[model samples]
Target: MENKEIARVLWETADLMEIAGEDSFRIRSYRNSATSIEGYPERIIDILKDENRKVTEIPGIGKRLASVLQEIVDRGSCERRDELLKKFPPTALEFLKIQGLGPKGIALIFEHHQITTMDELEQLCKDEKLRLLPRMGAKLEEKVLRSIAQYKMRTGRFLLSFAHEAAEELKKYLAETGGVEEITAAGSLRRGKETVGDLDLLVTGPNATEVLERFVAYPRVHEILGRGANKASAKVGREGLQVDVRALPRESYGAAMQYFTGSKEHNVAVRTRAVKMGFKLSEYGLFRADNDTRVAGESEQEVYDALGLAWIPPELRENSGEIEAAGEGRLPELIELKHIRGDIHMHTTETDGRASLEEMAEAAKNLGYEYVAITDHSKAIAMANGLDETRAVAFARQVRELNRQDRGIRIFSGLECDILKDGALDLANDALAELDLVIGSVHSHMNLEPAEMTDRLLRALECPSLRVLGHPTGRLLMQREPFSFDFDRVVMEAVKRGVHFEINASPERLDLNGNLVRSAKQRGAKFTVSTDAHHPKHLHNMWYGVVTARRGWLGPADVLNTLPAERFRNAIRHN
Candidate 1:
């Protein structure tokens, strides 16, 4: 098993243990081991198979955990997880996904009622029987109902990251099969949608029909849904993400790619344009309608040229003015990963971050960032050991000292200050003034009414130190909907106050989402694309933010940190 696969089992085991009322310390050990293995560079299986090496050498892996790891690598399962699964209904694990439901809540639901499925659970919530239970109340029932709706909406759909990883694996496998000449991701994966229902891969190769055999026998292939001469479909990964692979003839590769890599609306618009111009466009080729003679088929560029348009980028293939822009030669030069100059939103060991300030800076330097800001949490998040006024000021001094060193990267001291309930800053103005940048965020009271949330954000923007608003919508993808607020009003105030919106790069919380990002851009708001990194590995997630930026039609010029360190520093000051 891959390290990620092993870690997933360990995590599920921990969650199941929690539901089983296992000891707190033991459960924590499982969770910690999962985390350790997930980030460890080397393959745990390789280390385990080597007689001279011991997996226990890694932190957090004790003798018991080491044995558990061995069992997992050997048989892909452990005794404890099997035991837990046998005890709970099939939906026990599934119920944990509901927003307001916890393990204890699931355990209670199972004990009190013979609820077998989601429909029954929804019915239970509607019947108000859950409020009679311990800890859960009427509010929770309402929240669960909403969560179930959201969960239903997200069902069978995988996150873009999940599909991307799966695609990379398949692409690598197919490339290694020897005859594959080229592989291009099509569908929403190519377009970089935040969520995907399935993946479509278009391949051109000498062995057109033979690749399906190798794909069907892939180690991750859980089930072969179908097989054909030109295409093969399979359920891949533990998540059962559907993947379709097509082997294409090189002559029509571009046409197939353009037709298959479509948002249906975009495809319809382009096809209609072709029809009006007396051409028939299809996956086979673009041809003259009268003669049925091919006009263009070899390249996406040629296909677009045939349509009297410049080549449109894959990211802009959503019929949202991209077609018109392409015809007029006005499509944006969208932001790329190379255009990023810095990652300015990050945490350090001073608060919830796993890495020290020095370690994070070294990581950023290795990533070729011109500058990085150590934006640890402010006092509002006590659980994260967030900085108080004294600590915040001391941290600023420490960062200033670090800036004096020849570290090969510019370091900025900053805080992710909380926008508290009453619209006040978490730290005092004196403390905030000492920092280089402040990202005001809503960490609590997300349930506030729209007008109230707007007022709170508007007030937070009044702070001179607050250069950016962090994760403006407060949404956890597939987990929580964005908190309701008058986004237009808040963003207008932020723009007036010289504050930028943050496109937080964390996969789970890619807020502001692309829709909001585009909306804010229309209202004259600029953005800073940040990973909101809490660990060194998280720094690599900047590409995901770049994807969100490109999807929102952001050009490099629209992003503030694309500037060099000195210019960027001056721009965020709001002076």
Candidate 2:
């Protein structure tokens, strides 16, 4: 099993144990171990192969957990997880996918109504029968209905991050199978869409038969749907995510890749242009219409060169005028991961983060960062153990002392302060004035009317200490929608106040999405791409944000954090 698969099973085990009323401490141990395993940079199997290694060296893995991991790796399954599966009805686990329903809720429905399937649950909601159960009132029943609808809408799609994880693992596995020359993931994944329906892989090599055989035999393959001489399809893991693989000869690799990695609109536009140019473009190769003379097909660049244009980036091939830009040579040089100099929005053990200040600093320094900001939660978010005014002051002092130590990376004391519903700052001006930076955000009252939300944001931006707005929309992809507000007005106000917008890099909340970023950029508003990381490993999420920014057509100059530390400080000060 892959690390992600093993971690998923362990997480499900924890959820099942919670419903079964197992010991709380034991359940926490399982949850912690799963988190650590999922975030681990290297494969657990690689670690196990080292003679001097011990699984216990991992943060949350103890002797018992290590034994379980070994069992999963060696036998392709864990006995404990199998035992847990036997305790529930065949369809009971499906309830976990329904929002507004926890394991306890599922257990209650099963005990009282014998509801074992999604169809039964939906029927019960339609009949208003759910309200008969404990804690299920009219409001709760309505919420359950909405949740069911939302869950159904998102059933077949997977988050970009999740699909990327699976694709990377599969790519590595196939590349290691001797005979494969080149491999790449295509389709929506190549376009960097926020969500994808399925993964499409293209491979070119001499050992097509060997690659096909190896793919079907993969441990994570749940079912083989079809197989052909050079093409294969399968549903993988418990999520039933479909994967399709196509093998091609080296000569046709580039044309086939461009053909497959397409937005339908973009493909139509390209085909029209090819027709106008007296050439036939296809997966086979670009050819002259009258003589069938092959022109270009070996590389993607060559294919575009034959079309009298520069190569358009995959992220910009959305039929959004990118073809015109490429033809006119007006495409922006999009920001890259290497262009990022620091991350300004992150947390520490000071407020709900897994890593400490020093550990986060070291990790940023390791990434060749010139600076990092410790922007923990304010008191409004009590669950994160947010800091009060006095605590904020002391934290600032501590950061100053750490800077004095010259740790190779500059540490800035910052606060992710709450913007209250009444348009008041959570911290006093005196406290805010002491910090190197301030990030104001909405933590509650997300249901305000459009005008009210706009007014609230306007007030927050008026604060002199406020530098950036974190996750302006407060959206959690696949779980919540952005609140209603006048986005244009908000962007205009941000520009007037000189408060930069944030492109939060967290995979779950890539807020100020591509569309919004582009809109803001047209208005001459600057942005900061922040990881919003709570764990050290999450710092790597910067790549996702950079891709999102590129999709929005943003250049390096449009992002504030790309500046050197000294220049960045000056810009923030003047703002």
List TM-scores for all candidates, in order: 0.97, 0.93
Model 1 lDDT, full chain set: 0.90
lDDT of 2 at 546: 90
lDDT of 2 by residue, 1-575 (tens): 55777787778778887777688898899899888888788889888888899889998888999888888888766787678667766466667767678878877887788766677888999898988999887777788888878878888989888899889989999888899988899988898878889998998889856888888888889999999988899998778899998888888788888888898789889878988999999988889999999888877888888998789889888888999998999989999989899999999999989899889989999999999999999999999999899999999898888888888999988999999997788999889888888999998999899999999998998888999998999988877778889989989999988899999988888898888999899987889999999999889889889988988999999999999999988887732
All models: lDDT?
A: 0.90, 0.87
Cα RMSD for candidates in order = 1.4, 2.5
Model 1 CA deviation exceeding 4 Å by range: 127-139
Candidate 1 TM-score to native: 0.97
lDDT of 2: 0.87
Clashing pairs in 1: none
Off by over 4 Å in 2: 1-3, 40-84, 90-94
Per-residue lDDT tens digits of candidate 1, residues 1-575? Answer: 89999999899998989998999999999999998899898999999999999999999998999999999999998999999988887578889999878888898888889887999999998999889988889999999999899889999998888888889988888887788788988999898888889999888989866788888999889999999999999999878999999989988899999998898889999999999999999998899999999999878888889999898877778899999999998888899999998998999888988889889999999999999988999888999999999998998898888888889999988899999998899999988988898999999999999889888888988887889999999988888889999999998998898899999988888888777888899999999999999889999999889999998999999998899999988887645
